[model samples]
Target: MAFRKFSFLSLVAGGVAQTGLAPKKFNSLPLGAIRPAGWLSDQLNVQMNGLAGHQHEIHLDVSQVNNTDWTGGSGYYSNLEEAGSYWFNAAVPAGILSNNAVFNNLTLNFLNYVIDHQDSTGWLGPEVGTTKPRYLWGRYPFFFGAIQLVEHDPTLADRVVPALHKFVQVANTMLHNNGEGVDDWAATRWEDFVMALQWLYDFHPNGNEALLIDTMKMLKATGDPWEQVFATANFPTKAVDNTPNPFPVLTWHGVNMAEGLKALPSTFRFTHNQSDLARASEGWDNLFKFHGRPSGIFAADEYLAGLEAHRGTELCLVVETMFSGSFLYQVAGDPKYADRVRSFSSVAHSQPLTPRHMWTRQYLQQQNQIAAKNMTPNPFPNDGPYSNVFGLEPNYRWPKFITNSFVVTPDNKSLVQVYLGPFSTSTTLAGNNAVTVTVDTQYPFSDTVKTTVKAAQAFTYLVRIPSWVVGGTIAVNGAKATAVAPSNGLHAVNIAAGTTSLVLNLPAPITTESRPHGAIAIHRGPLNYAFDIPRTQKILARNAAEPRAVDLEFDSSGTWQFAIDPSTLKFVPRTVSALPSPVFDQAKPPFSMTVTACPISWSVAGDTFAAVPPTSPRCTGANTTLTLWPYGATKLRISEFPVMHA
Candidate 1:
């Protein structure tokens, strides 16, 4: 497979000159260039064998692409956003990254069908004909799937590119004429649509440059004022008011907020206004400052809830936030955004939002969850009683599409953006020299990361030293290289031709983060530590309509109200020859920590959720050594615990 090479100007400009900004700091490699290996590979395989692999069989109504309305069929049971388009968006990346033949074929078939059945009027999907009520939001995800497909298999470009251009022309007319297809959802999420357009303009313009740019301008004129909202005092400083109102209030919607993170930065590519880029940073800081949790995500059960231990965050929000962070890192070249991506991917992935088998997942996960049962007066303002229950379709299905890769710098050198689990990449460097870099490490679980680079010619490699690392060191070919302090959190190393071995040893020191009500969360490296409370799972009766799907409820069987002494934290490693296949399993954690804690007088909130940790709570029992495991390993946990002083 040959990868197309574009000039740096074309990579940043989208084939048009910008007014204010220069080229992007880093550019992403084409899809399928990076492959997951080692423990990360095991994780993807587990996902493929579980709910992701068989979602179509289990949830026929939503996942069955052939019978859905997007494919010009009669079945329109689910919303346009969640129908076949959603499944394709989630499955395409999974299939391409894991090289799964079944998933690849499924995506390819859907893409071909949609392209073949496209309406002569240039309207895509089922919302065809002028009389029909058209909503443009669903097409965004559908096109996202199409973009990934064409990137991996460029043969589809001849067909896919033309079809996309035709639709964009229609969209441009619609936006110009009384905002025909723009709804509250579409208006708030124009960022995604803009992203698809930018991709086309940058890679496959095909003489549609003017139309794409015009459509983006019209969308911005009519879309939500995310730039102003982030820059001004209108940004919500607390939980949004969720009263019943006639008008749609999208400011509080969890998923919208996650998508809005990149709205300004994305717009800046076109506007090239420095202020637009600055506001993007402001919005991210404000969101996390008001609603952030110890798990490295903000509170948004259905809306933006305030910083309370028991407030829940939706799984969809978590994944979307990760996506936004990844994009921001590439476009802005900020290390903080890379840190945000690593924290959410590592810590949030460890949370008990999904089961060990990845079969069923919760819509929302609480920071101090003691039970996973239905609540009578549902804690979430907009969600139902079963929002926290583990089920096939708890609320919605959100697929994980984020990947780890080496980013191409403006100077065409390779930059290791984020240090995730084992992964490898093959790409061409400057002068068309082929290179393959493989990273071998049990990272986040272990402090040492060994990278092997095989290149046909000499090139420079830049590694991001995380903001958390203070005494990190790098050795080249078994000898210590002269320490150069990182600039913007990146350390550069010059690599020679042939095979070069690099070892990076980052100190994994125990750290603590202060939480609301004087509680604290422990962290080592990227993994957050939590008290793994004993729990018993009861398999709820299967839904007769969906026999293959299973709903589960977990109840704590042991004490969860314990306050920890952070000073007594001791890292304990399990003596294993190799990391377990399913490394995140609660019963088989790769490592643990022994911490001194005591039973505290913590109470329940309305007997439905754990109450906020008491400020300086009185210890009720003698100190006992408690085992703390990775946050993702625990079914029931106290991630943010009140501090107990001796």
Candidate 2:
């Protein structure tokens, strides 16, 4: 397995040693509870499967020169190798340990490579003598892997611990060897080693805690710049050399390293310092304030879209954000993290590499609906099928990071996360050792959900019934069961079904919300809406507001009425078509909108004006009852309907 190029199958053809180590207990914030365990598992499986053949296989390139030559120190091939190993350690022994064979096979091969190569210093990873560079290298994989495998197999632990010792030696030597203090980006940094060592202390030979703290303190003294974000902005950087446009990118490495910083203390039992916490806070605040999209994802469009329309983001940033979101949720315990995770899962993670799982695009997404940076521009581009650099590039399966791991609350309770089709999750009944219950549901597209419970002993099961669940009746066997929506959001139920069945009514459907210009929009859940304007017609987008000037209003008659503020709406005369026999013509550059919906409404809520979307719209442009629905649905009709207030 070459370090720079990522491939699915393990590069190591041989096998690894067998070892059993103590498992590190997982303590993710309630972030992932918002998703069905099944859905999350399925996605993780896809990633793992892509990475299955690659345990012994590794991508160890390290020369950071990304120009046409691909030369020089080539950054660090070892960094990627460490990352691959980390993935195996953290992900393999997780909820879906069924996939252990994938990494087991890889570990078997890895042990073959590192076992005999250790010197007295005990370092097994790459370095030039005692002099090591100061940058992030993902070395914790070995320690984590050893810890996870220790209890189950001791032979593996014996073989791996020596390698960890060598790592500690080299790391200790690197900070002091150059005789200069913790200052700049060498091959590795104090924070980088701290993360790995922290994990090693928890899982490996119970590493040197005092030394680990000293190593970490180096980063504090070194100082931090723009502490609010993890990635350094290489705006207008050339995309991995293959793509045409030089994309603006916020590399995932920086934030990921900080995340690594976040990961370390838990294992070390070090109370997080206020400065590091401040750095993380300001970093995220700035990141979201600048690059955050409405979808809760930060921009990584490669060229860092400047005034010119030609920058791009990376596939890496998407996966990295998932990790960040997981951490933030742990700190804040807010539902927004779940919302962000759900949004990413529903949008960014769902798209396949080659429309199938067979291939993948190196840079996974684009901010502009029609990625125009590397355009074949004889014809203009708009909202059509977006594209990425799709092929069998390194990772088609268990990605090194991002979109790969599963989340769970510290205590096992199903958060009524995603309403999906036919899903099931099992956990021990609350406070009972012998009882286990698995709830299954077929939801969203359908109304009725069936849940079944099984246990050897009697216990209570608390299932969250979503607020969206309306007029629901619970039943056991064939009789009615009691259910309650305690507080505003959660639904509580007590069940002692050793092996029982449950049926619930999920009568949730789309709800309505009003938008700008007295226009009404339909909403199903958290999604906003846009009219599925047909390609044959042209419409405008208006975005402006006048202080104290109420120009649009909604009436009890179900129509949004507005007075024209010539400044608010303008038009860009371009026509587009919807689905075509051959193909859908891409959406055109948006037009300038002409009307504003900033008036008052006379709904039961009284005289205040709400920014509602018009539910009806068409060519007569001047006075139309523009119809609107939530952004999630739109097979037809106008979304931004206009109205006239007499």
Candidate 3:
């Protein structure tokens, strides 16, 4: 029965409808050259709430984003700054990708956003017009044309590449025209040149040699100090204070740049100049040396603070790193990069993005991401004010901390990492192999990930058994199977020719925990488990002073629940040591913070205060009790406490 169910999963994931037809030459464009359009295209359906053939609805949203008068400097509720053409970039492609009904319209409209704004003096930013960051904005066309027209339209590339080069030169001259240049001379110039090279190389593989030589000479001339440091890695270019304890080592920015250079592998496979490749290699060496964090992250915060908890790590940096890493994977053609890209995007970014798809926090403290309080109170962020974990911020669309917007080509082969969401992938398998994998299962919470592989051939399918999977049963046709082949996370699978059946049953993750602190952050799979306080804004701070005693119990039916705050959860020493919990190792002492007796409560929203509200408002303070639930399941339970003595 399980085998039958898995068979159906693969059939629905369709790919390469025209495999029998002659194949069109794939456009060999550099990854991260202009930001991938196929990545954007694949996400349209999900981002627009399953935009499958729903082209009109997308056009409407795109239109709104393009309407400067309507949007008018952010939304009315929150006085946040607005992107000049927030709608144009988002809407244009959404319409273009939905189908070609308005392709020309969106294409021209997007071009207006790109070309019209550059000044003769060479300045581009949102401040100039709808388009901001001239060089960054310039690369969008490159990405948009990648899937459909990178190679096919020779005339288009001839015109576009040269024009792009001219615009960048003008933009650079504005910044580095003389000795006095922008404060961020190296970072900006590096990005601009890299992007330009990617565009020229994409259009003309044997691109303008004179132009390339001239650009390299320009870089060698003027000769900024950053170039030598980046190219040579003399001593890792760093700003001290990366660790939570502030042991001076590496900064995140340096790590991001290094990763960017690694992206060159995905961008260019064959290069004539060895010097450029050598320069890129040195940057990568420094990337791992100083900035790599224990959490498998490159320490990058706006503050340049080391990899310490409570020190800020910007959400934007995480997205960019993952995006850049994906480019590196494409460039290096290494499975390790793919594995990191797939896992980090899921564990870090995808998990944080809220299901509601609104309001994302700008920063995350790695050590204590599970603080239940709002931390907005105490008129400071470092301290707790609200009951943490289940809180909301407006303007942050979707809690997805990292947006991994790329399609997994499940044609002939596929790879699964962080098995949590519902996915249907279509890919071309070996020698015109058409395979589609439609995985349908309530997993992570469930041990068995019901997977089905529907393909045109009967070939060996390599299913990655996660490290967490200690033991599992593999059933083929209801008869138990003893062995599976090529079990590593990386491998190109070939299903046997002329057979469309492949089913793999995976085991569940086993975990045990012990709590040493007064509070514990619950977790289920990638989601950090939480106590949901469900009430309007009024349900604030009622449980601010309460400490949850860990008492997680799973029922015989496999429904697990944690019974905490034993009615007497106050200034009490933790007695429940044997409970599933997060690792907060005080013995390591890598993180620094002073514990205090500063107890706080949530406001009832009656008065104007400067503190973050509690996680859940108290349903009642008059001898009323509140029950807690998880954050994702917002329909029931009270997360905050009633603040009453037992």
Candidate 4:
């Protein structure tokens, strides 16, 4: 198949010809277009009831209460980066998706404050004057959040768009002036800045196309050479060491690599270079081949940790990787990228990155983690001793926000790009017909999906068939089911006006993956099964003044040293009246699996972290049926186990 290039204008309504711009395969809908339903709604509520909803009131230092950088105060930049920007980013989607009025109002107030306080010289954040050095890295996230807000609530667009234009003008001037204000962090992850620029150009250029294009070009030139790095031998294939080398900062940094994954693809949009797109794909494959964990994220506590299951993968890296995967799926239209987005959203989010409540988060999560405590000589190369402990702002904090799983097809149809939990969306299709799509299913937990479409006129509804699915079927209104022969991984069904029903069943079977050190990981559908170990939580700080801001440590109370017999694995379905409040809670998993296993001598490194699984270790104790929960449900778990032969 010949590689195709698209124009950004081609996807928009009545878009004008814009030369030298690469086209996107898909474009995301506004914030409230898709709203959470079923267990997905419950997950968002859990976050709102936890830290995300109340961070400003509790985490005084980092939250917007004191960090008035974007609100015109001269607060520290780190505070905005760590908490303020991330809080707004998560809160906006959570608010719009869940329809929480308070969260919506809170986000709107912040937006108004920032927009109202824009500096006269087009500066957006706390770095206001030319007398001191200004860092442009912090403003990128704040603008990302601002862009989302304007997308969802366009009432602010008239104001927000103008503010953004002014800021970009100043940014272009700064970049052209010997790349002033472009620091190492901003230079390494300039793709995010380019993404914001591209969104503006695609949607609201308002006759400023030249300025947006020149700014993107300058940013790309100032940024790291991600295309060459990924395309050539410069990419790191091994665990990065602390000792300095000739490698650029993007090669070893985990978050940068995750964010940088979109650099070449975003660059391809403007450059229209197929090699740039191809190299982006190459970089993604290489990153996971050398550093991927069973939980669907690459290892990089701070740097590129290798494939050792014991190495910690940062929570920030997981979120950024998901975002990058989403971008890749949208621009490249690859089923593999969508498949990864689904896997990472289901498995990595369920892992011990954060508790069910979403109150506290880990700096680094380990696949072989058995204890969540402060460690002496921590296993993470670039993290502190307390990296694994869950706290309000463990090392640095960034809340996990929901990414758009649906895309607006160029033909004005809505496409389910990534299959997630139950959700519904209302949008206009071709012929100016209004349509509402309601997907009802416990997906990633169950293989069956039931979609109900209510439309004023007939239209085609598209859903992606994951790469793992084979011989899937789609039935319309209980009629004879047809085999789903996907073209480019999408199964499209024609629907009549008024109301229509769709039942899609993608068979999910138990599968095993061979891991590092001769260990094995189990998967059924999108969920990865792990050995759930019992643990006792200890509050690291019991400050009466700040009860909710205290840190927590978890110690394993049950035996975690086990090698599984994969042949004995059996899927066990549990009947529940309703899924629990915290969907990822260990006590209320909707379903689980039972497998015969025996105790083994899996030693510990650093006196706390579990060592690498022994290669084909012999079971020392009698075989027993052990219940395995979803990877996300367990706080202390062994996801990758040594294979014990029967």
Candidate 5:
């Protein structure tokens, strides 16, 4: 009952039909279609110095002859393929957009590696061994990476499309030979490969895509049915000891759950099954009900850790969830899913990005020292696909964060703005006329957004009014227009033939939200406010044998045991002439808020401060005027706090 398998065809024939679904529906924009402007552009440029840009530097080191994870090593496996997969998909594309020559060269080198090395038997990745079976996990990223590569350079399509054909044939054979038991990593994650297949089938329908899609689905259908996993809520919601052995199964793992959120929905895209949509929504509800945090992420150190504020979420899961949410929104075309993107972008993913950047600088210096020592297997866990790789890959969760979220309407007539970051989109209208729209604002810090649209002709622009903004208003060319209502999240305004300004005002007010155990978190719109506790860092060696292998630990500098006086919360904005070096930098935050708070007694278990704040902490210290920073700004913060006596 736990490991039953169901075919994609069986699901469709068993009631779900392909009728009424469009023969061709493109839900996502190309890799570089939407360009970043203002601070968002600056953030992309800053990433090159870290892991995102320098993958070529560590690629050879991590996959060389002596490394245990790659060819010629004792294991004779391709552990680095997953990391290489992301490098080509994200790091390379970002480098090309930023015009970083070194990164572009690195990316080309990786693409050339695949193009130059297709074996006579049509095998692509690292050399497969006789005794050990090749893992189907890394192939998913490589397939998607190839698709993106061709989008950037069509000449590569000649190489990429054939390579995928070879991979599909070989992998399909392996699936049948194995008699149904799927690899643990590959079982829950095959939806990503199915999605890639759908993308390929959309582009090259005449090619082997039709057969390839069915073959891949046949491969996945033999694995775990994710639809049932979520529909029945089969896994444990609490943190448990599965260490000495990996979680006997995969369903309960937080990262997999977060990444798999779009699985059933994506399947629904092809099957057009309404039940898949209902199940996807129910899965999300279950996650939040059991382990959701105010940080806009479900707690998972490595697994679902329940709704304890101090219980941390992985940086990887945060990024994956954002990607999943964005994909789900695009496929479902629902604004509610888009709102989930706003929360994670403004709070969860944004916070980890800055700290990952700081850690990356230290990581690069250590990598150089480690290389000089000639260590095997790189000993550095935070490289490539691992979130801790302390590189730009982890720092900037999605290179297409804004582009993927803001997609063209199905009719190719209008643009839908799902995210708040500053970006510009240029598209061809109905009559082959080109249109470009530029959005300018310091959103999450300020509620006002000004959009300048220059078009060949007049068209309807649909701007999404975020759910948090209740009393929103829209003005055309600086004049207040009552046509745009605040109640509906979607606001459509028509622009003249030439240049026109569409001003949107979403005033955010201070609000408090209750936590699990009598604690509360403050919010102004999408941004969550936290008590900025002063703290110092200590660098510790992750592995004693390798001095260069390190991670940072934070200790309370002054005192973090304080509760907010909910009545004295005052908001203040600091005028910044330019954006910070890294947009989420704590040292130079864009805004500040003053609050009156008193110290209380709180205990710390290992590294994290207590999740549940003291139920009735005595106000022993003086009521001092303390400064609270945005959730994304501070590293050591007490965002959920107990209420103090006036």
Candidate 6:
């Protein structure tokens, strides 16, 4: 199939004039429109069973905080404040509006508290320092949640719009004076403010809302200069040691990079400057090239730690990268941007091995393989029972919530699949109210997807063909579609009103890639397969303030040092009669696979699996059978291993 380049405006109304390529304009469905179906739905339901999703408990705590004087008051810093931020902005509102009954009323008390208590001037958040308005950073999440609330219930728009205008006026004044320190967190995280303000600018009922966003962008730029930072694109060198900084560099901090990655992309949405787009794309390339792991993210055990197989990525950084990619894909309208989202999504949802308690800790205290500048020395430094304590919420279970599964085409008439999984959705097309779509498949585990569309009238359907899928085929109404071809990572098909079944078969070949230090990473489909090492967990208090806060230490009983026989890298797939409940449970993965391997002489480094396995070491043991599990499903695992040479 031939490809064509088109402008973003073609997708403005969710309608498109196709000239042989997938349309560029695509927007997300309403927060709750397309929901998780099949095993994906089960995973979300399981998450709600824990603190992460216990809507009432989480929101109740949030309401109590909201009712207090901490938000834009004297006692603001008394609590983390973000504990409430995640509940309103992330957890409850999205879940509730998504039609999940579990979140019912969970969003109510919190919304009511904000409505009743928000100062007449539109100030929200704790009032700290002499400045009348506090930090710009804290208010962003509040508005993020408010936007979600307004979408779920439009009546709140009456209150939300005016309140935001007032807040914008106050923020504009602060930036004009350049006197108050309102730029504290906002200086470092100016991109997030851009994200929230842009949403307000796009969706606000008042057409003049763009002015508010203009003021915000102008003011925020003067403070942090993230736009300049991105345009110059200088800071993060290939390795931390290579940078000019003589001390620990806060500039390349993982969370900051994740949040800042979207700076240029978001700015391009307003400026339409081609330079911003180029810099945005260049930023992503540099990040992945120097620091990216097989999981499609760079090593930032809090900061840029260079590319080492075993260096752990902070869960927050992982989540933030996913968020940034979500924005970049829509802004750039490039399938490769969407492809990056899929890569981060798969690793985050399927192989997130980091325990929940350590998520909030700034530094990942894991076994380091390569030693570099500002990194903790290897072989276990003992300093009176060391715990790099950062008293923050662990939020381990929240990664499952870090996804926006579908995007409504810019015309609002069609839909595009972004995060691949079993899902169902309906959009108004040809003036029909009930055009239903049900997508059934165990994606990643199984590449075959069967989408059944039932429409009262005809509508166009666009399904994203991931970059990894080659020689993919589509069968419509049980017949192979010989005439249609998908080249730009998408396939467009027209569906007539009556029941139409589309079966898509994506090639899931067993593949391997060579890694640093003679290591190799294995994959089948979207999942990265790993050796599920047998181990026991030793629990330790995460800190003194919150003794209940704990971290896990694993002691493995099984040997982890092994080399796969590349010629013998066979995959035996199993189809289960039913998916296991609590599917993410480490020992109870929904699917299973077995492979053959040979044990090699391996050594440990930094009291954990060595960074690099011995390259082509002498075979210390006969060929043996080893079971490989999904990387996300294992608590203790070695996903990359040495390729042995006998």
Tens digits of per-residue lDDT for model 3, 36-56: 122223333334332212222
Name model 4 segments beyond 4 Å from true. 1-20, 63-83, 242-245, 351-356, 394-403
Q: What tens-digit string does per-residue lDDT give for candidate 1 at 1-646?
A: 0111223243233455664233667877777878888877877777777667766655656455545344334332234454677777877888887788887877787777667666887877655533567778888888988998887789989989999999898888888787778888888888999889988988888877777776776777767778666654656766774544222478568899899887877777777666666789988988888888777889987888888878888877887888888778778877888886676675445432355566777777887888888875567778887777777762322333235446888767665646555888888977888989899988777777889998898888888887777578889999965454688988888889899998888766788998889999988776778888788888885766556467888888889999888899999876565778677777566778989989989988765678889888778989899998888777678899999954
Instruction: Count the clashes in each prediction.
Output: 2, 116, 66, 4, 5, 15
TM-score preference between candidates 2 and 4, better one:
4
What does candidate 2 score on TM?
Answer: 0.55
Assess every candidate by TM-score. 0.92, 0.55, 0.51, 0.92, 0.86, 0.83
Q: Write the per-residue lDDT of candidate 5 for residues 1-646, one digit (tens) a residue.
A: 1343464555563565564233322266676667887877777765665544543434343323223223342211244346656555666568756867766665566666665666665666665433455677676776776787677677787777777777677767766665332578777777887778777676754467557656655655756566776764464555533433223356666678887897887677566667777788878777876777665667765667666664446666776788887887777666677776677664543433435353242111110010111123332222322222222223445575766746767777776677876888887766775788888987765677888999888877777777777677788897865545632466777777889888887877788878766888787777777765576666543434333324554445777778778899998887776667676767556777788888887765433335357776789888888887777666557778888844
lDDT of 1: 0.75
* Model 2 alpha-carbon drift over 4 Å, by segment: 1-104, 128-136, 140-155, 176-207, 212-269, 272-290, 302-313, 362-364, 371-373, 376-387, 396-439, 442-497, 500-646
- Candidate 6 wrongly placed segments (more than 4 Å): 1-24, 54-81, 97-104, 128-133, 179-184, 205-207, 223-237, 245-250, 349-392, 396-403, 429-434, 481-484, 541-551, 590-595
| Weakest ten-residue segment in model 1 by summed lDDT | 1-10
Residue by residue across 385-445, what tens digits does model 6's lDDT show?
2222222333433422223566766666666666667888765653554677888887766
Clashing pairs in 4: 6-23, 22-269, 350-632, 351-632
Worst 10 residues of 5 by lDDT: 365-374
Candidate 1 shows a clash count of 2
Give the Cα lDDT of each candidate: 0.75, 0.37, 0.34, 0.76, 0.63, 0.59
Candidate 2 lDDT over residue span 1-646, tens digit each = 0111212121111222212221222333111122233333444554444422332233233112112232222223244344544444544343224345645544444444444545565555444243664333445455544544553456766666666766666656654444233333322223444445555564554546656544444332332322322333422222222334221122233334324334322212333333434445444545554444433354443322211112233445555456555545444333344345434432334223221232233343332222211223211122121224332224422221221122233454332222223344433423553433344532332345576666655544444344444565667666865554533233444555457676766454444333334544333333333333332211111112212111111112233333222223323222333211111112211221223443432221113222333333322344332233222222122333333343
Q: For each candidate in turn, give its C-alpha RMSD to the true structure in angstroms.
A: 5.4, 15.2, 15.4, 4.9, 6.2, 7.3
